[model samples]
Target: MAGVLHRAALRTSRLLQCSKRPSRYHNGSLFFSTSSRRPLMALTGFTETQLTVRDAVSQVCSQFPNTYWQEHDENERDPTDFHATLAKDGWLGIALPEALGGSGLGISEATMMMQAIAESGAGMAGAQSIHANVYATQPLAKFGTAEQLESTIPNIISGRCRVCFGVTEPNSGLDTLRLATAASKQPDGSYRVTGQKIWITCAQVAAKMILLARTTPLEDVEKPSEGLSLFCIDLDRSKHSGLDMRRIKKMGGRAVDANEVFFDNYAIPADSLIGEEGQGFKIILHGMNAERCLLAGEALGLGYAALARATQYAQERTVFQRPIGMNQGIAHPLAEAYMRLEAAKLATYHAARLYDDGSVPAADVGVACNSAKYLAAEAAFAACERAVLTHGGMGYAVEYDVERYFRESLVPRIAPISREMILNYISEKVLGLPRSY
Candidate 1:
């Protein structure tokens, strides 16, 4: 198995011919190493670091092929084995600081890893199963105290501690400012959190959670974004009386559990509070750029996977004594999808590159990240739809796997943030338009 993985890693790494070029691009300004010949088939012109991340993740994912992912999805089970594989291999900390027992990589590298896994036919289920390790755990490293970091980061780096995020509210929906979950201050300075959180991924199995609640009342606070606080707390299932959880069945991504949780008088220690009080929004926002970039990469990968499947079927499945790929009806959509995915890929990686650059402004990063998410999600959905259409009846079959991809593809379009919200952001922030209702 080791030898097979090594050879596969080498072969997969050869997918892109990246010349000796320094890859760094600002918001729109690109800087490339001078080479008369460009890297053939290099869509985003990845650097050596990004290429290594992509190849390593692809090699790991190669072990769990479509059958593995499809089975987990069909059974509605968590991809715990796959998650363990990645954690054991230290892929969980691909972007973590080296001192924290991670690879000390950047979001760009993490993006490559996710895209590689998704493209390897694991789809969203495979990538998202461990997505929190990279994106959702950012608060710990950025805002956690030294004591918290020492106690927490390593467990997460290993497979010992799995985490989920709890921020969305059933009533608030995307209006985070209007969330009603309250964290009352106890006499001992601890917090007694009582609220309902929904759409929390991995809640069914997570040992920890990054929770956000109103430590101070919204009416008392000057700003709604204020009065919000962040907590990294233990999701002790034994606390059944305090913490109640129920799995939410969905159209896709069944391999991972999404749950609606109720926290009734969930006691949180003072030490579990991250950063300053009433600054949860800022702390959470610190990780949003990375999250958006990584999510975009996942979306781009799913698009590529769907396109690859459709193209393969077009080539091998003959019709009227000719390959369907030779027909314009079958070929054009795939070709169009390729272009769309390529465009989205460029935007996704560009956002990652921008975020990796420390000199870039925060405002620029927000615009780039939002735009990348929007484009990548849109392209991925379109490609999956085309793949389904190309497959016709076979596409709907479980064995074909396009239906799974199609179902999973909707995740990006509707998750983390909606396409409508993203558009509103761009209109207000980038285009300088008045905010729409």
Candidate 2:
């Protein structure tokens, strides 16, 4: 298995190198060469297996049209049917181990699945509706004991269970080490948790929660990051009577719910603990690089979809005797957006390759992941804005569909991690500067 993965990684690298060279064929046609100079296929950095997964996902996405997404957007309804279809098709477990009823694919395949979904014009709403199942329990897969893994992973992989992450807090913000959410040990070996969490996605529909809480006071711990623990607790709304869930109104991605969650002395069984005591922060950080890479791919897909729409509109719309694409003002921005999207896509794929190959250290992967995500978010936003501008008045009109992309593109820039936070990461970690925040 390791050998196969390495060969795939090598092929992916070569494909990326080939893609960077200028294409010899004109008019957007792929050219072949007799002497090892053929132009690389676009999006070719993905391995053959990855490509197969992408094609399969694309095939599924093709069944849903722009009209379908438009209706869903207008109604602010969940894509329960779509989610069920994916679950039935075994897509929800794309990254889980095969023994647990999943295909045991890596992040590359999962990223491609998300990218395909967004590129189909469904945007973040489509991806987020099914994203949590893809990799939300990676820590459990990697760190949980055999018995724990047997109990937790299969239910999630099979879509029989839904889990929401609880990391961000209202007061703590990104300063995770300073979180005040306390989980005190009880006489019965369980823990009583008390805290409030903000901006938790999909909480309203989740049956379980991957929670992080302070197990020891900051002053008593050797480091602020220590004394933190993770729990895969059952969100038994009845037993935890103090637990409160309130949905938040959001600018976009309305199909996937987001909420503020409050916990008041919620009791979680001792068996729910994910790993060794006082190690929640480390476990949570383990998934950050993968999360960033996935987000970058999703953002790249949105940019591609927006650019495709703009290009189509430009070619079809006529003014003053010719297609509007004949004008440089309208055409140049779309072209530039395409180039930016390509650049971001390449960065994201490269980061994924490095991660999969283990060629880069875990900490360095964070830098690469942040770079890819920041670039992709910026590129996607630019492409969506240009798409709307290209459509002129029709863009703002909900009927045109560009406005939906414009609204949805704003999400990748603001959530999970923000542009400012990425900048701070690069400054402090990459450049060895003092922490800004």
Which number leads on TM-score?
1
Give the per-residue lDDT digits (tens) of candidate 1, residues 1-437: 23323443575556444423443221100111232233212545788667756666765776887888889999999988899988888888877777878877789888988988888788899888889878988877988999988888889989899988889999999898878888898999899989999999999888889888999999998988999999899886774549899999999989999999999998888988999999999899877788899899999888887877787677678878998889899889888888888888888988998998979999999999999999999999999999989988898898878899899999999889999999999999988999996
- What are the models' TM-scores? 0.91, 0.89
Q: Write the per-residue lDDT of candidate 2 for residues 146-263, one digit (tens) a residue.
A: 8877887777765677778888898988878999989999999999999999988878878888889999999999999899998888887775377989888888887778889899
TM-score of 2: 0.89
- Itemize residue pairs with steric clashes in candidate 2: none
Off by over 4 Å in 2: 1-41
Each prediction's total of clashing residue pairs, residues at least 3 apart in sequence or on different chains, is 0, 0
